[model samples]
Target: MDGTMSGVGIDIRDDGLARVTLRRGDAGNAIDLTTARGLLDAATACERSGVRAVLLSGEGRSFCVGGDLREFARFEGEALEQHLLAVTGALHEALRVFARLDAPMVAAVQGAVAGAGIGLAAAADVTLAADDASFTAAYTGIGYSPDAGVSWFLPRLAGPKRALDLLLTNRRIPASEAVEIGLVSRTVAAGLLADEAARTAEVLRDGPAGAFGATRRLVAAGLTADLGPHLDREARALAAAARGEEGREGVAAFLGKRPPAFRSAASPF
Candidate 1:
């Protein structure tokens, strides 16, 4: 099923893939109140449908330029403050929902990526940028601060010093530099961006879903977990996975020298 809500497009495929596109391309896909709510709705839909993977992309030249400053400019004083709070509240909740999903998300970014756009890209499990893409932390440029998990994601992805440099300078960096600094997974030719992202998402969708979910949680937790406790957690997860349908099928397939049908195997996650 496919639907367009405000400035966001959601397409849930029969193969368990959710394609979420930012549809306000003419406005550089800027996030307004409606767009923020739409994203939350889309994320909620994907979760309800139990999609195995998600692919995020834009409709036009730019992925997203960040929050709609033009919209914000219309309000003043407490009105403006309240408007911003609503916007960030919806956007941040959407990000949290996406992050907690068992499905992995892949983002295909092109052209300009700035402000909260950086947060969306960084939040993805894998971010594929086109060679023509460029990134900038644009919040500081407008006398605003970071939102949409940018402050948290940046430091973790690119190191504290680099994150601070990007945030403070608001300098645009090429896709090459983004990959080198661990801001993105890899860069692809602009023409191939869509196809490559879809291919990657398809692979993830076909993999073992339950194991992927557990692994995702484990990796995120490992960042702050101590070695001893983390190892114990890993042991419990491994043991549980071994008894699951996907794991049993995987082992059987290996011994039989056959490819495992992970999609057919029921996932307990």
Candidate 2:
């Protein structure tokens, strides 16, 4: 991805994971209009490429400090809201696309994750962080309300009280504390974090793809549809999955008391 001016350095690897890196290392990998636009393209590219999952990371030491303040100089009267809407609209679109997939997303967060950076991380299905990483909201400190998905994602992941405290106080939380408060999935050793995340993602990718997707839909059902429709959807999906080859293999393995092979199976099974 060529976003030199934007500083949104996106690299898509053929290993079935795209890395959307914020590259403004000088300013802590801050997001700018160009960067946000680049991010929009990157998200589209990932889905278009059919990657099972994307691994969001940073190129430099910092994940993303926040939106670029230098660009703040360009802000005009009514254009302010329009500009924010333009870029953040891209962010929400990306989140919507990523949310549709059941492939487990693993965010490898390190260094500082502040402001909109938290939104990006929360968009992922799972997050893996170094024990030393730090997370902060920092929006109010700079005279802005949370523009990212913080309002929607944070409270659910980290719990209402913790999310409220962080957003209101603009406080920074250590990665260890984040784990304790449910902000991150878990803390890993600095050097092994990437490998650990990869292992987890592999486990997900190797599992029953349709079933996994259906499971995700079931779990997230509570956010919208009611009990009757929810159960109907769940039953339909589960039945479909159970009728497939993976389900047959799983059942055979259970009866035989042996691990059945999944990587190879008969067609239309």
**Each candidate: RMSD to true structure?**
1.3, 3.4
| Candidate 1, 1-269: lDDT as tens digits | 79998789999998899999999999999999999999999999988988899999988999999999999999999999999999999999999899889899999999999998999999999999999899999999999999989999899888999999999999899999999988899999999999999999999999888888899899999989999999999999999989999899999999999989888896322
Show the colliding residue pairs in model 2. Answer: 245-269
How many backbone clashes can be found in candidate 1?
A: 0
Q: Which of the numbered candidates is closest to the native, going by highest TM-score?
A: 1
Candidate 2 — which residues are off by over 4 angstroms? 1-15, 224-228, 252-269
Model 2 residue 157 lDDT? Answer: 79
Global Cα lDDT for candidate 2: 0.75
CA lDDT, candidate 2, residue 110: 83
Question: Would you list the C-alpha lDDT of every candidate in the order shown?
Answer: 0.94, 0.75
List candidate 1 segments past 4 Å from native.
Answer: 267-269
Best by lDDT: 1
lDDT tens readout by residue for model 2, 63-179: 788787787658977887788888788767767777776555778888899988888877777888888899999988887888778888888877888888999898889998888
